[model samples]
Target: MPDRIFDFEKDFAGSLRCIPMAVRLKLDLVGIKLSLRQWSRLDRDQRGRLLEVPCGGAADRHTIGAMIEEWVTATGGTIDRIDPADSANWSNTNTVPEVVVLQAKGEDVSAPSLSQWRALTDQQRFALIKLTRPGHENKNFVPAMREFGLFLAD
Candidate 1:
């Protein structure tokens, strides 16, 4: 299984201080909300395992979800379960969500065309959606776009 952590996240991926986008995507897939405090409780090895595990099917999601809940609770942290259905936006290759477009425009980058959006991997789409949400730091938005080849030449 591939670890989908993005290149932009490499700065803190070693320490696992911040939750990498890959884990965030997995959390969405498994319907578990992992708090940063909870994530901090895990060592680098554990965080690495989370990145390495694949959540490709129903059984995989179940195993990861149970493992996440168990790990968080074992570390005296809580797991908030979210409905992954809300994450459907990333899976839709047809329409590029407005939020993602607007956020890109706000960054002085052009919105990705439908063809460009369709070309992205699900994890890339997930990262873009998460990076574009209101209140997200967004410092990495353009870099992620560039990495994904969704950014146009300036």
Candidate 2:
């Protein structure tokens, strides 16, 4: 695990408050999926180390899941399962966050499978969500997708 630092000021300033990679890592570590708006509610220190802790590429699904559980336990936040009833509402196009939706506009449009998405760490999923928005620069999108092991068939 390398010392991954997130520059909040440089990356998420003004209208584009992109979710920093560090915070993404923390969200993954915690296991419970979070919206960007939810992430915005966390305190500074909680946000800071999201990138500080080194989660190496060697991390597998089980290891990542366990780490996420541990992080949530230590942080005192309850992890809830996504309700089956709420499945239809999970990615409601009408209710999707503006920033996230913006990232998905105009690309090879195809939604990732639920199982595939679920298998990914929250950080990876978050990165994909952010990158796939409507108006985002395409250059960043492919790199982000590649880094997260997404769109293998393309």
Candidate 3:
């Protein structure tokens, strides 16, 4: 599937005001951490290239990795590399994450079932995990769950 900038992110996605989850996932995959402030300093074209660059194979990873390194340097940001773990909560299809469920339950919303969670695309799962993070805005959590058909906000 093509890279996505989800509907909840559309408003800022056009302006790159906030980094899209697709790019965020790619950054995670490549072990780079990009902050929104640093991301905003980049020109629109560069931001667009980041979204367009193929991010699948090892060769593609190298290409985007180099591009991100250049962009980080130009933006006066240092890359804080993180090794993406294969065992992350989002990567686990066997069970739904408790925090996600609790966050939803906090709002009286139902979180996804195991079957539904397992059915989600990695990026979709990533978006949910991100939307539920501590101190990060949880406003989009329900919308995302709805978008993924994992919940119906009543």
Q: Could you give candidate 3's per-residue lDDT for residues 14-34 as a string of tens digits?
A: 567789888888887777787
Q: What are the models' TM-scores? A: 0.92, 0.36, 0.88
User: Model 3 segments beyond 4 Å from truth?
Assistant: 85-88
Q: Give the winner by lDDT.
A: 1
Task: Give me candidate 1's TM-score against the actual structure.
Answer: 0.92
Give per-residue CA lDDT, model 2, range 15-90, as digits (tens): 2244565444444444457556544554555455454545544354345445545655666665554321222223
lDDT of 3: 0.81
Candidate 1 residue 7 C-alpha distance from true site, Å: 1.3
Which regions of candidate 1 are displaced past 4 Å? 152-154
Task: Report RMSD for candidate 1.
Answer: 1.6
The clash number for model 3 is: 0
Candidate 1 lDDT, 1-154, residue by residue in tens? 3456688778876467889888888888888888888898987788888988888788998998888888888888888978874567988988999989899889988888999999988888888898887776888889889999876557
